[model samples]
Target: MAPSATAHPLRGREQGNLPEDVSSFVGRSFEVKETRRLLSESRLVTLTGLGGVGKTRLALRVARDAQRTFTDGTWFVDLSELHDADQLAQAVASTLGLQDWSVRSPQSVLIDHLADRRTLLLLDNCEHLVGPVAALVQTLLRACLGLSVLATSREPLGIGGETVVRVPPLTVSAEPARAPAPADVPGGDAVALFEQRARAAVPGFRLTAENSATVARICARLEGLPLPIELAAARLRALSVDQLLERLDDRLRLLTRGDRTTPSRQQTLRLCIDWSYDLCTDREQRLWARLSVFAGSVALDAIEGVVADDGVDGDLLDVVTSLVDKSILIREEVDAAVRYRMLDTLREYGRQRLRDEGDPIALRRRHRDWYEDLVLRAQRDWIGSRQVERVSKLESEQSNLREAMEFCLGDPPSAASAMRIAAGLYEFWIVRGRFKEGRNWLDRALADGGPPTVERGEAMCVDSVLAALQQDTPAATVSAEEARQVAGRRLGPGRADTGDAAAVARR
Candidate 1:
């Protein structure tokens, strides 16, 4: 809900409650045109999509565009963080400049005041209380013939004669084979958007042929999703384009930089996804965390195997479908098999939830085990006719494998498991030319310095070989000597990493 009436003293009737845009509205020429056309034909129009897909922005743009058509005014009611359904009517009334002190109901005040006004109400973030919103909208439309409503939500209000428009991510160029010329940059909506936000973050930043490809790749990696793109662009204040792209694999952390003027929920990717996460039922929330184990799109069988446990005790398919309906999961088809996946930002949020509220170690171990068994199967079948299929399978699971290894390396007890997984991926690392990454993982696992074992020796040897291939002779020699020492005797454990104990001390 918005601030109290005193905080935002009632404005003149001409201003209404429409907020001025803090940043330029980027692409969506076609969306604006189509939405305006729909509003002309229908009294209720809903812009629906995933959170941070620019639904609110699009609705605002459309409302401002058609403002002159409404003789009374265009008022905006923000329901993004509002929880109390009973206050919904009062919130709308306040936004419409109504300050009735009588014992009359807020809904009654709104109806009587707007009965003859040709007003357009911009209802933002109505997904949480669709029932109340639908009822109120129905009442207003029935009473006020000149009234129109434009709503933004993850799903429809389910009202009769309502036009639902699904907003999509901005269009991004295909991954370029090579850096395109500056002429090609303006045509891509996502690239243009990043440039705009980047300029705001760093006034001197410009889209040049030299940096355009990196910007384009950044947008492509973010799937042309508006909020994430804006968040990424804001990082230009501290990070160069190359640094930004390299750090994007850990996007939830890197894209946290957001505009301060926006609401707290809109200030970071995690918070944006958190709003959606909070709206789910407990079962759906659990399923969401479990499904985050996968790296990319996952088949239903895999989802059921990983998520349909005792904790999530219901028809799993129904929960999956419900998540899709709520825009929490994206449903896709590959080779006639249906699969589901979360956006990278959403996946990271689910992973954070698993760490904060669930048994993250256990779930990550399960994820590792599942992928390990698949790797063994693929290795066994590599000699057969299905070798190509095996390659495809491993490639698809690459991110999952990396995530598993990351978890293993972090837990003290799982260092050996990390070494074993690193050993198993020797060939994959070579094929993908990821020698440096392979060496880094091996080095971390070996740093645990457990008792001398074959896994430790093998990991050291692999690290030595990778360092040699990279022409780091000193590191190669040191790693080779370490491998020999590991084969001979026990090693002292490394110091355990500390947390924010200092922060508590400071407080």
Candidate 2:
């Protein structure tokens, strides 16, 4: 447990405002230390991360720890409840316990009060109030030489000379090859937080050899998010560890029991997400739900093709930027291309919204069609100088392509396109050394009850090639003969390329 602001009252020595932390603060020693170090070197330090990752808690802890550094004392102000930009200065002034009898503006009063004072202002939840916060921060820094601010938000305020630190989820242990020792169980920060919260909830809860593994699994599944872990730990009052794991896939419902003493928005996992969701514009929300279509990370072009639809009207890139800013989507660079992914929990939330507002089947069809075209383009580019580039792109989209294949093989099959896509990636499989998996997908699509057609011939050709690579001569021979028969039926022995493909497979 950390010392609350109430425990250390503001007396004659210190002259600023800070709140008492009601709940026990969990792991984040490194984040707190690094944040303080950053604040010392930079006038403005912003802690940025997705909701429920504990940016506010970490910011408070850092401010509390750095009380002695500022001669005028450290101040804490939460901006989540503040909505009006016009009242932003009043909020800050009120938090600092400032009394102004003069007719000066609130912003001016704040600057004048802190003009010669060395102090820290810790601002929490600034994403919704970025414009006003940025303007105020810039103005204060230029006017007051002794003022420093440590702020937390989903994104940076982007003020000049502001140092931004991205707060990552707590570290979890890697999946063990065998049952790990109880001593090693507490090594991970996420598991530590879970255990601490669990003990507090159940009073006598213990992390022995029996439940350590399952507890670690829960921590990892929650992606080391502090709030969800705490909520999940609270449920252990009734549910067993294994039962908790079973229900975690639908985590928004599973982790609803949060700290009752906290704010309404902080009382449940869904509400935390709702808070962030409500802050987004209509276009940003629509794009967020639509992006749930991706099975894994996707490039900018894929997002544009899939997300820019009727009812959702905005520049696709701009909407994506907004999502990234609000921490709904995570951006990463893969193979020199920018790709974005939603956390599994966030993706599930977006998927529910997508199903509610739009037709999931229609969206899936479009997704399948786009992936089919992607395979065909990769096939075309595989023979050119861009072969390496194409291979990388296909590798990144492999999960999405698999999703497309599953959609195609769904009841009432779209077998023709399925077979075509599976077969089109034949070169990709061979070049990327995934022949076995490719052959398995091709086998499934070929048997999916499509009428014999040119695509079947193409699939047979691909299957024959993969069979040859594995040195399965009998299977290769069978596939080659099938290709020849299909080619003969579809092209009447007139297609030279089909005949050549059949001959190569037979050899």
Candidate 3:
């Protein structure tokens, strides 16, 4: 386990900020220079960029460079999988041991304790939970006059006192069409990084006139990003650089190679992700592949909406929680709320497997029904503060929400399920200011005819409500009256549905 600051004292990725091997910092000289200046000038400095752009490495570089500026030495806090913002202070306190953070009010204890200490705080991976992390940062900076913080995130924390250092990908030169290896370009940064990664994969690998230009072009295509470069390099045992380049479309195979010696884990970046994936049983894999249908991070209950197996009744939450534990999925943080996400590369891997292994027709229908049903439930939960907690929980689980919706729009699942999910999300869509998305989904769902089911009436009712919300008062009145009339004729007076048909209509 890593030894960063956290409420429960994280057991992995936290044993320390990073390893002592300064072996991979081959090409980021410019980033290091400007980052040093930012740390020196600001109390809080955040290195922000897309995932795998070397933010963690840059932050570590700054901490190493800033070693002399601190009196108490530097402390690191890693919040990469932190799902709850309420746990932020406890996590910090747990790692710092500044006070008893195991209690319910760790933030107060943390503020009081940090008020007197002079130190450098290294907070890595702050993007997923910028709001809460930022809130904690604001509090800490306000109270701790002697503390300075250095963080890494994909985006800025947006706090008033924060100075954000935008970390771009490692440098790349244009690859000429059908490029040739340039033997004479000595000392280029791209060549250096490629040689460095290749050596890590195959001992003694180096740039020769024969492969130097080929190496350089591969790095350029990869944008000199370390993770992908390293992943590609790890395949050198079975692939020449050229062979690997040709197989870029099947990136999974290109990135992974046999490395049983490296703990059967951490063999390659692909292996690292795969170990996390394989640790999940078949069911988890199925759920993961289905969940990959979502883009970006999604809330928890979103899983409940999109992933129940059509062939059998399965426990969706248990499966999701299992993925989180295995590290195949990540629990994300929003201010006061926790969301979840699948890494982009992993999501791609899952989607392919989902298509290959799932029963296409059945899975599609199930996907539609589940999301359709879940959205209706979500709609009811959105209005009033009555189900705000549940609503947030839903938002957190689907980590792949955007992708899941795409699945709903195609073929057999279209129209009926789309209308139901769209109409149900109207209240939430409006409140969350998702104005355009709500209208799009509603319009798509209401476009034409739908399958006849117990859910039809409820879906129609939801459709009317959304129309009303969109300011069609007459449509709203007409739909509500139709719902009452339908209830009287179909359900009989005083024996009206408990809206159970809406639940079954999703069938």
Candidate 1 on 211-290: residue-level lDDT in tens?
87788888777777787777677667668999888766443444544433332333445543554566578998898887
Candidate 2 residue 103 Cα shift, in angstroms, is 84
Q: TM-score: which candidate is best?
A: 2
Shift in Å, residue 292, candidate 3 = 12
Q: Which residue pairs show collisions in model 1?
A: none
The segments of candidate 1 whose C-alpha lies over 4 angstroms from its true place after superposition are: 1-11, 175-187, 249-507
Q: lDDT value for candidate 1? A: 0.71
Question: How many angstroms is residue 13 displaced in model 1 relative to the true structure, after the best TM-score fit?
Answer: 2.6
Clash statistics: count for each candidate: 0, 0, 31
TM-score of each: 0.49, 0.50, 0.48
Q: How accurate locally, in lDDT, is each candidate? A: 0.71, 0.74, 0.60
Q: Which lDDT tens digits does candidate 2 get at residues 363-472?
A: 78788888999989778767878887887688678668877887787735578878888999887776544455577678888875455588898898888877766656
